[model samples]
Target: MTDLSNAIWRKSSLSGSGNDCVEVADDLPDAVAVRDSEDIQGPALTFESRQWSAFVSGVKRGEFDLA
Candidate 1:
């Protein structure tokens, strides 16, 4: 497991004023960390930089859009 003790997390810009959005940390080397904004010390999902980029692209393209 990567040591994320110094990770800098940021909430998505698309998020509303509420704190119901997820947080992402890209300060890690070669990997991106994603976790719930409400659970800062909770479990996090880590993905490769490229994988995270693809996911973000998909989101921007509405690939996971709900009806």
Candidate 2:
């Protein structure tokens, strides 16, 4: 398991004042962490830097958008 003790999490500013979005921690050297904003202490999902980058690119390209 990756040690995310020092990870710095942040969510998109466009999320508004609601706690319904996910938080991302990309400050880790080897991995990026993601977790529920409403559950900071809950388990997080980690991805390799390259993987995270690809995922982010896909999001920007609307690859996961619902019709």
Instruction: Give the winner by TM-score.
Output: 2
Model 1 per-residue lDDT tens digits across residues 1-67: 9788999999968898878989999989999999999889999999999999999999999999999
TM for every model, in the order presented, reads 0.87, 0.93
The sequence of per-residue lDDT tens digits that candidate 2 reaches over residues 1-67 is 8998989999999999999999999999989999999999999999999999999899999999999
Name the top lDDT candidate.
2
How many residue pairs of model 2 clash at the backbone?
A: 0
Q: Note the residue pairs that clash in candidate 1.
A: none
Candidate 1 deviant stretches above 4 angstroms: none
RMSD of 2: 0.8
Model 1 per-residue lDDT at 63: 98
Candidate 2 residue pairs that clash: none
User: CA lDDT, every prediction?
Assistant: 0.93, 0.95
lDDT at residue 66 of model 2 (Cα atoms): 100
